[model samples]
Target: MNSTLPHLGFGTFRLEGQTAFDAVSMALNAGYRHIDTAQIYGNEQAVGDAIQASGVARADLFLTTKVWTEHLSRDAFIPSVKASLAKLSTEYVDLLLVHWPLNHNTVTMEDYLSSLKEAQDMGLARHIGVSNFTVAQTEQAVDILGKRVLLTNQFEVHPYLQNSKVVAKCRELDLIVTGYMPFAYGAVLKDPVIVTIAEKHGATAAQVVLAWMRQQGYVTIPSSTRQVNIDSNLKADSLELDATDLADIAALDRGHRVANPDFAPEWD
Candidate 1:
């Protein structure tokens, strides 16, 4: 994983309409060069619009979007990426990810990985990766991808679901870990420890949580619809947490996960 990439990114999950567009614009203005979106989010076009509206050069930005679970097959994956590119109004994405480990219509590891390779070869996506994948599944991807593909695994990681095992495996394999839901879907904002730390650092609870993940060498994308939250989220990048602050937040772990859908596999 290249440490050069921005550790803090903008997440466009559950955001839609003019709110999503405005939030993305605010994020861009707040110095967020990385934007994480997905086909399922149905807001790639808005993200594209925001990028264009921001006047940021294509090369200066790191745009990531995912192939939906329904489009994981070899036959559908490449075309799906093309569709995403069209929606995003870009020729290539900085990173393209498989949104989930399982496909609705049954896709093998080989099938999905081969399609990812094809997407890369075609120059449709600059990098290939996966999201919501477990350690075993990521291992399977690495084994199947061999030396040709670089697999970045994105998951919901926060203080509650620290995801130590997956983070360790990713470290060993040199894969980038994108930590989504870094604020635990706003649940961690109310913690007294986080609030106290935020007050001491002159930051928000969200910034403290995001800064903790960034300090751990994981990429974090925390979503926000409000302009204040969007601006506050970007401040996480400049936040420096001491060892004691890290320990305090780390102790808040309760093994809670906020984004587990019924179709998603158990993360270990």
Candidate 2:
């Protein structure tokens, strides 16, 4: 499977009701061909409705969704994926991810990884990946699944919480990095440095942050419910920052993390 993904994609995490449908439709109209949704988000049907409403051909888009932690077992994984498919109104997803590493008591890593592989084999998901996994967990996955088809490791990566260790290891192993929470959960927009850079580029702070992530070769899925923000977010692909601009933004790192799950598995 190809490891390189588009630099920018639409994320549907907390969106729901007509808000999600309209936001997704705006994103599609703004030239966003990649959409991210997950079963845990409770908005797959809204996402599916928006996708269909856009009148865009399914083949023209890259759709990704995740299997919830509670559905990590071999038996549960299959039906979970089918249910996700039904909600998304699609037969196969461009990529499907294990939402989180299941706790040891719920299912062993081997069991969950095997179920993910089965989903791939059954043609429910074209490519398989994991989210919120540490570098150690990723290594374990490679050890168990081999090097054939682990396409990506999705996580909360941004200017703050740079995740340098995991990013370097993923690069060493040729695993693509998909960065979630690219804005640092609205903190990036308020940074003076990012604002200055955005002013120079005639782009918004969010656009500059997204561009920065893309320049680092990380696929970013940023969520927005506003039509204007959704449109502006897709423009991240076209904005380019020079070396100095990149350095200024990089200096904003303070190891700030916004999406830490207390009940989640240990991360390095």
Best by lDDT: 2
After superposing candidate 1 on the true structure, give the runs of residues whose Cα lies further than 4 Å from its correct spot.
103-105
Question: Compared with the true structure, what per-residue lDDT tens digits does model 2 show for residues 124-151?
Answer: 9889998888889888988899885788
Candidate 2 clashing pairs?
Answer: none
Worst 10 residues of 2 by lDDT: 1-10
State each model's CA lDDT, in order. 0.86, 0.88
- Residue 45 displacement in candidate 2 (angstroms): 0.8
Instruction: Give the winner by TM-score.
Output: 2
Per-prediction tally of clashes:
0, 0
- Work out the TM-score per prediction: 0.95, 0.96
True lDDT of residue 209, candidate 2: 93
